[model samples]
Target: MLSGGSTGVGLTARDELESTISLARTADKRGFHRFWMSEHHGMGAASVSSPPLMIARLIAETTRVRLGAGGMMLPNHSPLLIAEQFGMLEALAPGRIDLGLGRAPGTDGATAAALRRGADANDGFPQQVLELLGFLDDDFPSGHPYRQVHAVPGPWQAAENRVSTPTGTPQTWMLGSSPYSAQLAGQLGRPYAFALQFGDADVDTAMRLYRENFQPSDALAKPHTLVSVSVAISEDPAEARRQAGTSAMAMLRMFKREGYLLLPPDEVQAYQPTMQERHILDAYTDRSFHGTPETVADRLEDLHARTGADEVMLVVGGHCASLDREGISLIADHYAMPRSEIPLPVAAQ
Candidate 1:
């Protein structure tokens, strides 16, 4: 997943947002199967508040790469709206759109409250997911409140127009950092994405739960798991650690509720951390995959072997766009991912 997030060390919001496009193009050219943007609200460091809008822009710039929200926080918006947005995206990209839904707020408590408008939306995530599926498929049960309200540009839209979209609706995946989400995804028979970068959740346990509880669905015959991890790769191991430290510092600040902006490695080195802060920072850095491409690749391979994840999504951490892109290229080269001969299309200015 090429996240729409930046460290915000020395870059403007516009620079970071535009850099996401460049990164997406690189991911596409290098044959990364999916390029997913994340949704984060009221965060200075994360400029992407709307994944669908970014996906739309990416669709125009890249060819062959699957574009998706790595994910959209479901509690913040109406399920029908999400259905319509992703439904339209599926229409545009055919088999290339994924809708990864998460129950978390993806923001602080105050920001989440503002987004939810005093409603307790998180608890209804499962129901909302079902409603969203119903809207996308137009298959609500009789007497259901939303049975008559169809999501335009959805499967119903194609049927109404007699348009043949053999590619089908947007592929939905469940995203979470806990067992609850793992079980939910399994019960629904949806692909599950465990975000190991954000929290200290046990990937082994989560994957076990997902597969053990798995039920077959139309989209997937068996359990499909994607593990997303934070990674920073460079020719120099020390340089990779430095880049990784920038993100670790940013995460530390967010944990302390101080700020979300990422500082440069120099700044991170200059500041003296408290003993407790050092422990927290170390824990964050320890779980991340950082070092030379060979080292990171070995770690990623080990993780995949342990968890049996169908896909491993790298949350590449770096202080600059060039570094991030370079890290991506290095990892792709290490894995021997196929590259496209066609040049990436430049986004409209």
Candidate 2:
């Protein structure tokens, strides 16, 4: 099934945030299975600093698309608090909520330090995942320090002990671009999402490790996996590449520690790249899928065949809101995704 991933990139935070809502609505109408927003702090290129808040907003705007964080960086906050926030979200949307957890800081060192306040929480990601799961399930072992703690509005609060319809916990997913997270997700039997959009080179190895270590758990019966890929699709291949170049430029800036900014396509086309910068951009472009809908769809199909991923999450790329939405629509059309008959709800005045 097709899904979407957004980082809310635009010229301004307000515009980017609003664009995300619009994109989510479009994704829902186009029959995309899920729509996930990413969390990034102190990045000018990305407006979403809190995926939970964005997810909640998207939930209000869309009718049936699964809403979630592409992920919430676990080390940046307390497990109990996350459990509580997501629990409330699950209560609000029932089976439509997803909580994809990740181990990275989701920002630069300085910003990460500010967020963590000198805590070395990244090293304890596995423990935190367990703690968060415990809170969500309200099933911590006896004598555990947090045994008495409960995430209110959690799965334990389902009416009549029901696990369907109006009562259910958020579907939990493990998001990562590395082997550590892959193995952990497998060991815990959670659905794993590999962030291939970021140009991670170890996708094959990571996927292998995850399946090898997978263990059945209450949350999952088999090794479920999704690979998030960067995509730029258009009727014209050249136009698609032009749009994708902007993202490559942003990646180059980020690698240089110059901060991330998605320059407009015209500006990106005019800029000159040094040999090293050119290498970075070329590598990113090579790994990303950008072309006409036919080409991108074929690449995605090949990816699934190679990795055996259960789903392919597209991180549609472009320098503007319209192009991003267009890319999503084009892919859906190419795949013959069923269109939703439900119209988007009108916003309040």
Candidate 3:
């Protein structure tokens, strides 16, 4: 599971991210495979504008968990810059980095326009992805425009990346909520991750297409996949609903162009929702998996079996770090994930 550090309506921004790191320390010990953050800009609700910076901070704070972006909107910056930033992360924590790519701006139209000025990222995503790989691999073809260019920390690239070596590159995946990206990932022979958190996209069809069209390559001899979902689980069903409600309200606020932050379930309960709004909320809640750990795990297992997903990433619903951390512990326990025996640092205490 990953949190972009959803800063609640009244909470301080620092707490949102710092607390995720706090949870990451727990995730490190709990044997979670990876810790990733989302990239959003010009939003008061989310403080994770620079995922690379956060990933670096996470590397310094914990050991063992692979850190990277849930995605970085590639069109917003130079490909070489992304390569160098991740190259540095690979340098800091050799085999512990992932680079998930998303075409979405991760922001509103005005903000995205401001970020791109005029370039259309959606149109250039494929080319940009290839360019990024070339730089990261230092394999631009003969006489190519950027043939001579090399990403810094250039010595540590895919060619030299191995568990036997201290330096390694990130595990790259194309992230999407649609089949287009799924097909593209297959065509490129890269790993694919589909987001089922939104509730609207048909992840099953997308994943099926990815697997069907997959072309084996050096990076992956077969299709490697992961699916992301929105979930909230608790022994008490009502409590589970309340936790999931916070996320529903947060999303409602986002859609309405209102304030963008998680709201306590109490507030949501007290506020009067229109009939249509209530219906939407009800539908969304029904779509999410929630209950006891056993119940939730069973549902997740079914999803895993149905989608044939090699890995499952979660976006836990909550209003604070404690709720998210508790969610992590439950899921980790069910999966029998690894745990660290070391005690918390004095400062953390």
Candidate 4:
């Protein structure tokens, strides 16, 4: 089932992060399998500056759900560090962690440069990926005998509180909005997560390409596709529309803004949108699985069955604050649980 954490915008970034963790923990208690967060940089709209770090924190906070970076931009940092950080998290959280890597810098050129630690413009991504894989495998031959080198905090030990790391590396995934990413994920035998929040310009094509190019690895013997969508679910469609409206307007505003806009839920209804807002909202609206739990569940099931996707992730409450405990209750009861048999804990105050 779909699950998400906070994107952390404005003054609420930290608090939102906590709330997201709380929410994900609650969802985990309710049986959602995975919980993820997106990565972003330097736009006042959302504070997803360090998704890996945030994911590590989330791993610490939740129990059963797999914690993942909806994506960490690959080009922005050293792959070794990414491997190390995720390796530690994998060790800490074991089977319940996912590493979703992306190729984009997640920011514009200058900001990308600032994040890159002075690396030249053409740093090798394919090579970096290979190196990362090497590190994940202890048999990579980088070192041996006298001084063996393996990923620190590798999945060898089973801590009392942490789950065992499934006798292999963390489940690796690739996130992209393009066919190229689909091809790459397929070729690498990793799961593919499409950023439907951006736009599904070629979603079907991407999925087809992924399945066509797929090569089986130890982690995935076949192709598994996941699509991420922005959704605002509430009993009141109009209220949901109004609440997610600011985010819709913010998205419209981004055509001229320096960075992408991911408007928060609280700001949706109160903000005045521009003339182009209707068009922007409509475009994403086609993809959003909103409405009541039954309606949303029907839409979600249709999307999954149509795509044959193994899973879906929704960014709920992005544009509306009206969704609360009861809304989540509805989702947990009907949409998230396998048989609607699992009882969710009382909502956290």
Candidate 3 lDDT by residue in tens digits, 1-349:
4544667777787888878787788778888887888889877768889999889888877778788798989998899999999988988888899999999999888899999887566898999999999887777899999997878765544334543453457888899989899999999999998888886899888998999989998678999999888878676778888888888887777778885668878998887989988987787777777777888899889999999999888776477667778877887788787667756545455
Which residue pairs collide, candidate 3? none
Give one digit per residue, the lDDT tens place, for model 4 in 1-349: 4445434245366656666666666666677777777667766655657777777666656557788787777777666678778888876777877878887876666777788765563357666666677666544553433124455655323332275434357778888888888988898898899877776557888899999999998778989999877766677876556545645555666666635555665554455656676667666665566677777778778878878888887766453222633456577777446433333334322
Best by TM-score: 1
Q: Which candidate model has the greater lDDT, 1 or 3?
A: 1
The reply for model 1, stretches above 4 Å from the true place, is 1-4, 346-349
Q: Each candidate: what lDDT?
A: 0.86, 0.84, 0.82, 0.67
Candidates in descending lDDT order: 1, 2, 3, 4
All candidates: CA RMSD (Å): 1.5, 2.3, 2.7, 4.6
lDDT of 1 by residue, 1-349 (tens): 5554674677888898788988888898898988888889877788889999989988888889899998999889898999889888887888999999998888899999999986578879999899888988888999998878989787676677887653278889999989899999999999999999986788888999999999998879999999999998899999888888888888899988987877888998898999999988788887789999999989989998999999999887467778889999999898898877656556453
Best candidate, lDDT: 1
Error of 2 at 172 (Å): 0.6
Q: After superposition, how far is residue 162 of candidate 3 from its true place, in Å?
A: 17
Task: For candidate 1, give the lDDT.
Answer: 0.86
Give the Å shift of residue 193 in candidate 2.
0.4
Q: Against the true structure, what is each candidate's TM-score?
A: 0.96, 0.94, 0.93, 0.83
Tell me the spans in candidate 3 whose CA falls farther than 4 Å from its real position: 1-4, 156-166, 343-349
